[model samples]
Target chain A: MPTLSIAELKKQANLIRQDIILMLERAGSGHPSGALGMADIFAVLYFQILNHTPHKPNSPLRDRLILSCGHYCPVLYATLARAGYFPLVELKTLRQINSRLQGHPHNLSLPGVENSSGPLGQGISQAVGMALAGKIDQAKHQIFCITSDAEHNEGQLWEAIMTANKYQLNNLINIVDCNNIQIDGKTTDIMPLLSLRKKYESFGWKVLEMNGHNYGNIIATIKQAKNYQKGPVVILAHTIPGKGVSFMENKYDWHGKAPNKEQAEKALQELRQAV
Target chain B: MPKENKNKSTRDGFGDALLALAKKDKNIVVVSADLAESTRVWKFAKKYPARFIEVGVAEQNMLGIAAGLALADKIPIATSFAVFSPGRNWDQLRISVCYSKANVKIIGSHTGLGAGEDGASHQALEDIAITRCLPNLVVLAPADYNEAQKALAVAIKHQGPIYLRLTRQNTPIFTSAKSIFKIGQANILQKGQDVTLIACGALVYDALQVAKKLATQNISVEVINCHTIKPLDKKTILASVKKTKKVVTLEDHQIHGGLGSAVAELLAENYPVPVKIMGVNDTFGESGTPEKLYKKYGLDQEHIIKNIKEII
Candidate 1:
């Protein structure tokens, strides 16, 4: 794979952020905080690192991407549409009645989604199973599970962590959107994670910590994580609750709330100026 | 023919079938929650170590992991005692497997008080109710070893989620391996017109025994083994009920949501027969031998015979 410049990656992340804002505004109801927080990581993944075909979404050899924090599916829907998995016009039908772009990604219902994941903690476990299956079937495809920092609190997540490490699933990579804000309040204030990187290391995983908003760091660390062959890998990416939008950044209120038309315009303009 | 019978645990049937199934299809995997020897999955582990997963007594995680494996297109037979699988980890089974429609077979070993010495904590009386309530889930309780083996094969081939509730104590092997086994379809072991006796799991044998005793007194009884409880064989049940206006439903589980209630629900809506439910009546179980518990809870053959007389 050819190396991408830091400037180019940042420009792509800004475009993804604009799409997130626009999609949420069109859908009229969706999460904004985690979606914005995960824009750079998502950009680095879909555009640079991940192996997929937009034309052949169900290719057996394509790498699998699972969103454990399903509430922020707008980011994935927008990213998939922009990546040409489907028409960008389909983005307008997100969360509407009988729309393919449901609030949660359904694997068979949507173009690029590999599995249906709405209930938390199950998606990562399912990803681990997919990665293990790849090993069992001798496939070279990788499995990337995107999780919320708050979702890690679930006991089932630890079950997946233990199983992934026990199987030594080297092809499994986890991206944690560590933006700190959750539905109730700040994750630290509600229930402190303290140090997530150390937790993964203690569980026999290869841990990588980087700035989630920095496209260069996300791409570099993701590449590094994918290189190790011993056990599962996780990138603990630090990010603002909402990165580009001034009023929503670091605010827990915007965790699951969608931006109004005026707010969406402002957010898109901010992203455009930043790009 | 004096009802040809022998004694063997239903878990052994599951064990024998699991090992045989793995030999034919390497996709068949066994997941145990620290009950390999108890649930008889250890036999599979000893033969095919690569296909077995021992998750050490975490029922919830076991169920979730099984669902994950199913999503990856692996046929996972998750084994645990009935009390734990559906009794303790029903939420996981409901959401991860049934709601998602994963192809995972839950082998709930030691179903009913037939588990004998392990007593209430280990014996699962409510498993049928828990699993039967979920949509897209098929519930199967085989009578004996041969029936269990055949049921295991059927469960493996069936799409979506299926729960195979097995027993610990040695019960009579009434049916041969050649006996037909079909999911969501009941087999009538005996034909009668006076009254119908519908049963499942260990109580099926007891129901048959009572039917024999009733025949001597000129009271004819129909014995139906309702293996699949979710898609509850309503056609056959209604056919039996049409001939026999009185119904006697028997099971080892509680009469409320178990087989008895399920039958009553069907009968009330479709045929409105006078039904007498014979099983545990709105109570939890306690520590006792399988025989003692069955007798105390009115789930024994004697109880079935007495109930048949009263209903007739």
Candidate 2:
């Protein structure tokens, strides 16, 4: 597969960020911090990394992506549309009564969504099961799970972490969005996670740390993590909440709050000027 | 003529059927949270080592993994004690499997006082109540070994989330191979008009025993095995009750939310009949022998017979 160049990927990520701001503004209620923080990773995953056929979303041979933190579904919806899974016009009906784009990711309602998730800490475990199935069947498809840093507060996350290493799931790659801002305050203030690198290392996982906002860094780090044969690989990607929007950047207020028309305009303007 | 009574735990029947189901369907995988032998899934784990996944002492993760495997087109049978799967990981079952519409078969073994000396924490008296409330989740408590085997076959073919609640104790296997089994359909073992005896799980056999004792006293009784708890067999239940006008509902679960409450709920709205709900009455079980626990908890045959006399 010919990879998207870093310039092209950056443009895609910018376009994705714009869509996130637009859809969240239109929806009137959604999470912005993690969605904006994960735009670059989503772009790299769909365009440059994932072995998926967007046309045939349920193709048995395609790779699977399980979104653990579902409140940030705007990022997943935007990325799927950008990847040709659905039309971009459908993005306007997000959070509407009859729209397929649910407030939380519902796999049965939409195509290309591997599993339904909204409640945190379950997606990682689901990815383990999918990865374990691939290993048992000797399938080549990989399973990637995306989670928020604050969602680690759930005890089930540690349960999942233990199961992944215990089974030595080589086909599973976890991408953690370490934006450091949760709903109410900073993660350190709410609940000090201390060092995630040491935590994963001690769990017998191959830990890869990289800058999530950088397109080149995302591509390089994910490529390395996928090829990792030791055991389960968890990539702790450092990022800023609400990246590119100066007002929202690093602010925990935007973690679960959607932008109004004025804020959306400013965020879109910044994204358009950069790419 | 009565069917042969095979003494076997419902958990063993579940394990035996799973082994056979896995043979035909290659996608059938067993996911356990370190209760393989106790839950009777050790056979499947031993026979199909590659197909079995043991997530040690992690019920929440076990459910998530089962939901994930179902997404990948694998029919995952997640096994654990009733207190854990629907007990500890109900949210996972609700959000991951039930709400997601994943094809996950959850076997909650050692239900009711079948957990025996494991005490209150291990007993899953509230499992049916919790699982029955979840949308798109089918709940089953097969009576004996044969019904358990047949119920699993029915659950596997349903293609959605189904909770098969099993017990640890050996009960009388009255249902034969030829006995008809269908989801949401109850089979009336005997016909009478004095009163109706509706039971599920380990208490189904005891209900039959009490029905026989009531017969010699000239008090006619009708016995119905309500194995499928969620989609109550309203047709069969109402038909029996309309003739009798008095009902005695029995289960190993608390009288609040198990089979008894379900029957009372159905009858109260449709046809207000005087129903006596016999089981654990608004309390928890303790550590004791299965027989003593049943007797003390008002689930034994004598208590059931007494309850029937009061209702009549």
Candidate 3:
């Protein structure tokens, strides 16, 4: 696979960030902090890193991507639409009564979603299962599980981590959006998830720390993760809660609150300028 | 006449059935939460080591992994004690498997007081109530070894989530290999009009014993083996209850949410018959032998006979 130019990936990430702002504003209710924070990572995954095709979402040989922190599904929905999994206009129906794009990621409804996830910490275990299945079949496809720094407070996450190491699931890649802000306050004030890198390393996983907003860094770290075959890999990507918009950046208040019409215009302007 | 009854635990039947199914369908896989020998999944593990997964004391992860395997088109049978799988990891089963409509089979062994010596913590009295309430989940509590084995095959063939409850004690296997088994169909073992006895799991044998005793006393009894708790066999149950007008429901689980509650719910809405639910009454079981627990909990044949007399 030819590597995508970093400049092209950055432009794609900016467009995804703009879409996230627009979708959340249209929906009238959705998370913004983590979704905006994860734009670069999502852009890198869908455009550069992941071995997947939107045309054949259910292809047995396609790579699997599971979002453990499904509250930030706007980014995923935008990324999938931009990748042609569905039409970009369908993004307006998010969280509607009969919309396929549920407030959380629902696999049965959406074609590109690998697992339905609303409750935190469960997607990793599902990803572990998929990775283990890949191992059993000796398939070359990889499984990537995206989780939140706040979600690691769940005991099931550690349980899944242990199982991944026990099975030596080198095919599994776990990405933690270490944006620090959660629903109530900073993750440190809420649960204090300090020493996150040491935690995964102690669990026998190969830990990679990178700048989540840097497309080049995100792609390079994922490439590094794919090369390591000893056990599962966890990339702890440090990012601002809201990366593009000035007022929302690093603000815990914006963790779950959606931007208003004016705020959405401002965020979109900033995103367009950044690109 | 009933053929010579074999004495075996339903867990053994599950293990044997899973092994046989795995042989025919390579997609069949076993996922255990550190209860391989206890839940009898060790047989499959020993036979097909690569196909068996040991999640090691993580019931939540076990269900999640099974759901993942199911999504990948592999039939995964996740085994653990009843209290742990549906009891400890019900949230996982609900969200990961049922809500997602994953083809995962959850086997909860050591159901009811038949868990015996392990005491209240290990027993799964509320498993039926919890599992049956979830939509898209099929709950089955087979009567004995043969029925348990047959129920496994039926659950495996079904396309969605299923909960198969088994017991630890070696109960009487009255159902023969030739006895037909279907997912939501009830099997009528005896025909009578004076009263009806609806039982599930290990208590089905006890209901049969009480029916024989009631016969000599000139009280006719109809016995129905209701293996599938969810999707209750309304056709068979209503037919029996309409004729008898007096019903007795029995199970090894609690009286609140097990077979008794299911029958009462059905009867109240459909038939409105005089129903006597014979089961463990709003209490937990202590450490004791299976026989002692059954007697103390009012699940023995004597209790069924007495309840039938009162209801009649």
lDDT, candidate 1, A90-120, per-residue tens: 8889889988888877765788876666777
The 10-residue segment of model 2 chain A with minimum total lDDT is A1-10
Q: Rate the local accuracy (lDDT) of all candidates.
A: 0.84, 0.90, 0.90
lDDT of 2 at A75: 91
Error of 1 at B178 (Å): 0.4
> What does candidate 3's lDDT look like per residue over B1-312, in tens digits?
367576998998888888888899988888999989998988889899999999999999999999889888888999999999989998889888998999999999998998999899988889998999999999999998988899999998899999999999998888888889998899999998899999999888888888888899899999999999998999999999889999988888888888889889998988897888887889989999999998888888787888888888
Off by over 4 Å in 3: A1-4
Which tens-of-lDDT digit does each residue in B282-306 have in candidate 1? 8877878888898988888887888
Residue A245's lDDT in candidate 2: 83
Chain A TM per prediction: 0.95, 0.98, 0.97
Interface RMSD for candidates 1 onward, in order? 2.2, 0.7, 0.8
Model 1 regions more than 4 Å off: A1-12, B1-5
Q: Estimate the TM-score for candidate 2.
A: 0.98
Pairs that clash in candidate 2: none
